[model samples]
Target: MTTDADDVRSFDQRGGAAQPKALSAIRTIARREIAEQLSSARFLIIALLVVGLTPLAVYVGARDYKSRLEDYNRLVAEQQKMIAGPAGREVKGFDVGWSEGNDLAVLRAIRPPEPVSALVRGLDGALPQYWDFSPTGIVTGPLASRPQRIADVVGHLDMAFLMRVALGLLAILLAFDAVAGEKELGTLRAVLSQPISRAALLTGKLAGGAVTLLLPLAAAFLIALISAQLFGVDLIAAGALAKVVMLALTAGAYLVCFYALGLFVSSLVSSQKTSLVVLLVVWVVAVLAVPPIATMVAQAASPVPTSQYLETRKDALDLDIRRQAELEMGGVYREITGDPEGNADTDKYYKNKESIDRRIVPIEVGYLNRRRQILNEIDRDAERRAANQNRFASLLMAISPAAAFAGAATDLAGTGDAQYAAWLESVRRYQDSLNAALFDDPPTVMIRNRGASFPAELRKPPTVADLPSFAPPRRDAAAVLSRSLPAIGLLGLFTGVFIIGGFFAFSRYDVR
Candidate 1:
């Protein structure tokens, strides 16, 4: 019984000619395996599934992006109009007049939809697309559009979803019977008796099967890009194109993880049926069960307060501060006018206006400062808790290669939590800028005089250009790649573990 090692050593003794022969053997086996997989009914079915579903997913995602973009544009226009007044000339039809009391009225900042979300809609759909800033506090706006209830159940049809679910299953199907079925048919013994080493045989099978599995995926990717273009999604720009390429590479790595896992299972089992059943169960657990269960566990373990609760608390705080300020101002008014009811005669009121304001303005400024500090504290606490919960969920979900792939894909596509967080930080900066522009100086109470009721400085409306505009932060490719590294590393780790396991298991596999 000459082993493959003995055959290899004998060939090595023949003047180093064995290297080329072994390479030829591996190539031959790879080609044969590829032909077999391409001719199989299962391959055809899976190919059709990829080709048919990818474009549909792209279409749905593109339509959603368009709708959100429209909403974003409309909101931005409204915000600009509200700030600059009608026709940018006069303050006609404006809700808030240019008065001291109404200086810090509601201001808004809108986040535009990411163009790459036409392929992967991650936290983009879930996170608020706008924020409102006011004297009281910042408020998160509602989602640009509500997702269908069915989408909550079935999930969004996007490239990430298809790669995680459909392509993962295809990888499993293609590799589940690679070694076990050959053994069952007694073909493994005949192949092992040939001049090829076991390592070469395994390498050939892996190469051949990967090619078979990835060809359909490539075609599906092409179709998806084409569909995105047809629907007016701009994925061809240099930055977006780079992200798309990264996404494609991430998908390839994810599928390879499943393929290697299936091959390892096939080598470990004695029968093809047993191998397939085992791989199917693993696939279900990894793809369908792990991500949601991780989320549930994370939520249960690290609960955060709801947005409504925080909003209510801030509202209550604002009311308390306002009531306190009013009481103090009333006391000041009585002291200045020597009227217990603070109802001084018009002549007396006009005469003491300056004196009363000097006493009352400090009270108003102090209360305003107190209110902002308390509200900002509450917001920081909420954000910290939410961040902790997200980190925990991400750690748990990393157990599933599918989830890892989704994370990487979404991050690259600029639709992930990282991108959303960046958007939020930008909005906060804009909020701060707006506050400085409107309230840097303490506004003085203006008494109605015989000539003008409003301040002479505010006679003309301020144009939109007068205010600080929001400049959305753009993440360069390097920054996005850095953010995606953790998930990408997890995927690579999964692929390595499965490939090593398959090689080790197949080395001892019995074909008798």
Candidate 2:
């Protein structure tokens, strides 16, 4: 304690009392804080934990990414090969026509996992990695389901976890006693006799605390990033350096938020023990409690209809349309072919029925149109309810800087919920294009006697090389930064508000 006081006093004496500057005092305090943080055993422990755990996480995640990419390539290759196999290839007696080959929708809309996921696995669970498509339509596989259990609590060891949870706790450790600890040990009174102002003291602690917290995390992140490249991830080589830069800045903001909160609590409490307790309580509420509680409240307030409800309604409507279409098409086929009572022969009767089914497929489009409209209504309703629920969560964002920072980092990294929405829309558009290519024309059916419907001579299906390629949309840095501006603003506001509060509390704080 006396050494800390002497450290500050000696700096003031070196400059002489006649030239006691706030800048000098603040710098002195900041340097001293940095020295102490580096020398502490806790700093070594924190450093080892981050550096040790992060590369292992990256290595594991990178292996999974590599595995999934190989699967995607292999599946795509097999699909292309099968489509080029044979014309009139029989699948359950349905002739694979030239046009049918052109409409081969065998490829799954599977996006390879992003390499940056090693750093930030944001919203990856909520977004599907796979989707299946056939000529009729495409179906998105369900998002991964995680069992809610205590073992699943600290789920992944990505950079998000390191920053939001681990670094947050580390920040508190560095800051919980920034002011109160000094005061308790008889250093505060001696230090205040120097040129330092309360505002300068606060500023020094904030700056030094932030630097101290970020150094280890940044070093560990860079090391793990290189380790990932050794395992063939190559995130930086893949032009993700920009994303990594933004992620680091955003993560730094989160660490600073927690550090400032600790400083604010330390300033308000008179004792180090009391300050530590209050900071811990605030940390628990902000980190653990707010998110889940907000989610439950939002869900209750603005309920979205279940997926089963939508599917059931869609199926029932489709069945009704099919039944109506059959009745209408039966009448039309008779008028065109004049086969009424001409079905006297059993062979004629079967031919007439086949003819009706051929025409009915086209007529069914009208009913499918109606079904799409109803399903669209269901979709729009659900989207509206979800938007409302998001607004409610935003209210919680106002009070939780941790939430704000997490959101901003994820969005900027292109791994947030917004990114997930964008990916979904892209797939939907691709599906619409695929549907148009397959179903826009009238259905062509084969007669029972028309042996060898498509020539067995044409060995392969028509080339689908002209089809548009599905390029997954890329997230632009400028656009992402714009979207995340609000969250960044909140982080800034929280830091400023807490630091200002700390200044006020420390201005009149008893030093003796």
Candidate 3:
């Protein structure tokens, strides 16, 4: 009366002779599972859902990317034209004078849509598209002409979304009945009557079900890539293709994790219906609920100031600094003109204009520099807080395989938060260059008859060609892979944990 465990031990002891038999048993079981899945109505329906929705999602995403690209080009052209000043006319360049009324020279750094956004939208639309630079600091806002619609708020359907929601659900459906349903049908008892080990049986089921789930996904993914390329996305580029491959691998791991989880649940439960119910609840929680709930929790835990609050604080600081400068300049004016009220004779003011500017320019420059320092501090503080909040949210969301896969997919596509941060860093570098070109040379300020004026030489602004232009930073495949590796590793860990759990639970599962 040898138990199944004794049989497994004996089979292992048989060594070389038993190895081929075990492999053949696993292969046979896998083939049987694959045949059963392919003929099932539920599998066909889900496969059809994925195959049909993939093209539609890609088409919609491509069209949206085209619109954003068009808007980006138009804004960039306008920015260049403005920087060049009015054509065919003699234009006064920036008035680099210490006058509160004079506007600072402003430049715009616009971010173009990532080409791979057609497959994975990530933060492309939500992130700031353009940043306006001034001597004061950077100001960020969306294009006023293109307001965010409901669709943008809800999010666009892309390959990542389809993988997380549709394919993930499909994976669960494929494996939810893998073990328990066989037990209920009395097929498990018949299969276990053979010399096949439980480990081999589970492996066969996992491999076959994975194939059944992944075939439609792989086909649909290829079709989506082709559709994106046809719509003018440059997926054929070496770097882009590599990222696409990484994205595909991420999607596969994500789906397999769900399948493994289903298999684990099926083994743990005695009834197929109970296993499915439990798996569906887990899917809803992991896929539909976790990421957003984690974000909200992180936000509440690590509170950060809003952009509007930061902007208001900066504006108040600017006004206070400006008022302080005005008071200091008033005293200088009173001293120069020998008037308590600070009213100066037009003739005397002009006569002493050079001396007045020599005295007052330094005072104005000091205040301006002080304001820049304080505003920069505010911006840096806000950025730090935001980064902390984001990092915490990411850690919490990584608990879900769906979120992990999405993070990896978006990073590979160059449409994730990391890429957006890189764009912002480039904008900051441009701001620094602009500051060096313009603000580093302190302009003299002359107060005459209650008006501030600059020297004739200062009226001619720096050459447009000499000014720095915004060039978006590009991340190579290596950098993207580095960013995506953590998420990929997490997905792999999830798959391994669930598969191990399934193996352990199925070993003790009652087949009688």
Task: Give each model's clash number.
Answer: 0, 0, 0
Question: Candidate 3's residue-wise lDDT over 224-340, tens digit each?
Answer: 888888887777798878888888878888888999999999999999999999999999988888888998998999989997898899889988997888788778878987878
Q: In candidate 1, what are the lDDT values of residues 1-512, reduced to their tens digit?
A: 99999988887887655344877888888899899989988889878987899888899889989999998888778666655654333321121222433432234567788878899988777778787665444667888669679997888888888888988998899899899999999889999987778788888888888888788878888888889999989888888788888888888889888999988999999999999999999999899998899889989999899978987998898789867877776677678877776444566656876675566656655665677678878998988888898899999988889889988999888888888777778877876775576433322323322233322222344444666777676766777788899899999999999999999999999989
Cα-based TM-score, every candidate: 0.85, 0.81, 0.85
What is the full ranking by lDDT, best candidate first?
A: 3, 1, 2
Model 1 ranges with Cα > 4 A deviation: 1-20, 79-107, 337-352, 432-471
Q: 1-512, model 2: which lDDT tens digit per residue? A: 56978977886788646554778777888888989988888788877788788888777667656765666576667656654654113211122222334334344566656667667767654466566543334456545323325525756667777778777888888898899999998788888877667888888888888888889878977887798789897777535677777878888878888888888888888899999999888888887778778878888887777888868876787678756765665466556557562222344435555554455445655554455555556666776787788878778656887788778878777777667767767776775664564333323332221122221111122234434445566676776677678888888999888878888888878877
Top candidate, metric lDDT: 3
